[model samples]
Target: MTPPPGWYRDPHAPHLERWWDGTAWTGHRRAPGTPDVPPVPPAGGTGRAKAVALTTAGAVLVAAVVTGAVFLGGDDDEAETKTGPTATTSSSATGLPAPSPSTSEPATGVPDVVEDELNGVTFPLLDGWVRPEHVAQDDVVMTTDGTYDCPGEGSVCRHGLVVSRTVTATDQTSPEALAEEDIPEAAEDAFGEDALGQQPYGGLESHRVVKSGPVAVAGRAGYFVRWRVTTAEGPGGYVQSLVFPSSVGTESPVLVRYVFDAGEDGPPLADMDRITKGIRPVTDADSGGGVGSSIGPAH
Candidate 1:
């Protein structure tokens, strides 16, 4: 029997024939009873032509597979490059540009304002008083009115001056308002009853109610008041407290209180007299020539 038009006898098996349609072979089988015939050459030349056609078709299939693989690999590489580690998301969840190069440098310039050596304590030898030794250390400057066998002792020792400036507030109320308001309980714990009173000195015109007294060293004026009470140190201590406001409207004032150790009679009335006299108001165009002077000492 003749085989189908597109069928060929298997070269290796006599009983089986395979189908070779235009393209690849079909692995389908014929019935066992089907007769097998040797393939005949075409009019043009059969074996070589058929072999060449089959070879060319196989080459095309290989090329297609290879091309598809290459295309898939290239796509994977492109995807990896786009999502690689160097790329990052911003806090806003959007991709951001890279940071710029830095050119930072350390700062250098003038120093901070500080007190000079003589800035703290000094006595310029006022008339009718002698500067004493015990309170005349570089840290403390004390001046006295009367004579005493031992310095810083005795009621006849009269007045004593002790000056200290710190960035602390001894009173909860302002120095201008201290005498008028009840003393804060905390102040009594540290400074005692003598720490009361508001004495007027001089102040800038803007501080209509606050007073300022003589700060002979810096030409600053502050308020002065006497606290006739005992201290953490001793009994019968006299404190001629001076308050220098930090600025026209600031709350905290720099206090320079002079503690004198002059018994129950307190420092000679002369000592208080000297302090009141020495306390001068700062004279400035804005001062209004003492319009807001404190009526008596600040409470």
Candidate 2:
């Protein structure tokens, strides 16, 4: 049951104490022994718990932004640290921001749009795609439902994957530089060797740049680099790294990576363009920022 209104360890910053007003975390914080300030009133009804099917819409990319361990590691341990909605209070001491409740009904279906509010953007869910579960550290990720036994032993790999996250690991701001630097690592994470030394695509042998240059994404200027990767084991696919200024917040660089298996088993290469064109600021929906789309059950 939700604990009675009181102070508790701050989930975002364990070094301090924060108030939990019987329903949700509040912005009020204090040192362990300091006198408690009046608790902030809870907002409306209780917020929805974290969804098992998808990450929170406003999930922030705090802490380590990118690490080898985060790329499709498929670890259950990461899920254990995820908490419910963050308080909407403007206090900076509240640690990471909490997600607003999702509008999609609690059903075994896919929403037409998926949001990464922390980065201030939304992604369109295209045909043959669904929100990914268990892909650690990706602020927003989706993949084709179809999967096959990984060429490497002891794991499964999806045929297509798309991931977007803020580039918090560096202070750099140029989208071109960030996109170029991230593609190689993105390719390695998808087709090359993993942390466990498992070559999911039989080890990325080489990559040929298919396209590289400036582009537009989500109404922001961006840059993208797409490569056709060759693997030693399976038919390798295409990988693209696109970086753009976030539509909201500090305008920190946001990275969107795409991976698709080669040939018929993977999503159409055109999907990358479709998805890119479909991205928009979450505020745009009511302002004509989005196109008409249909919601469907997860495949």
**Candidate lDDT values, in order:** 0.29, 0.57
Query: Candidate 2: where are CA atoms >4 Å away?
Result: 1-98, 101-110, 134-137, 286-299
Q: Residue 158's C-alpha lDDT in candidate 1?
A: 33
lDDT of 2 by residue, 223-294 (tens): 888999887777778988888887776777777888888856779988987888777776664332232221
Clashes of each: 14, 1
**Candidate 1 TM-score to native:** 0.31
Residues 229-254 of candidate 1: C-alpha lDDT, one tens digit per residue: 43333333444445444332232344
TM-scores vs. true structure, each candidate: 0.31, 0.63
Where model 1 places Cα greater than 4 Å from the true spot, the runs are 1-128, 132-139, 145-159, 168-173, 177-225, 230-237, 246-252, 261-267, 280-289, 294-299
What CA root-mean-square deviation does each model show from the true structure? 45.9, 11.9
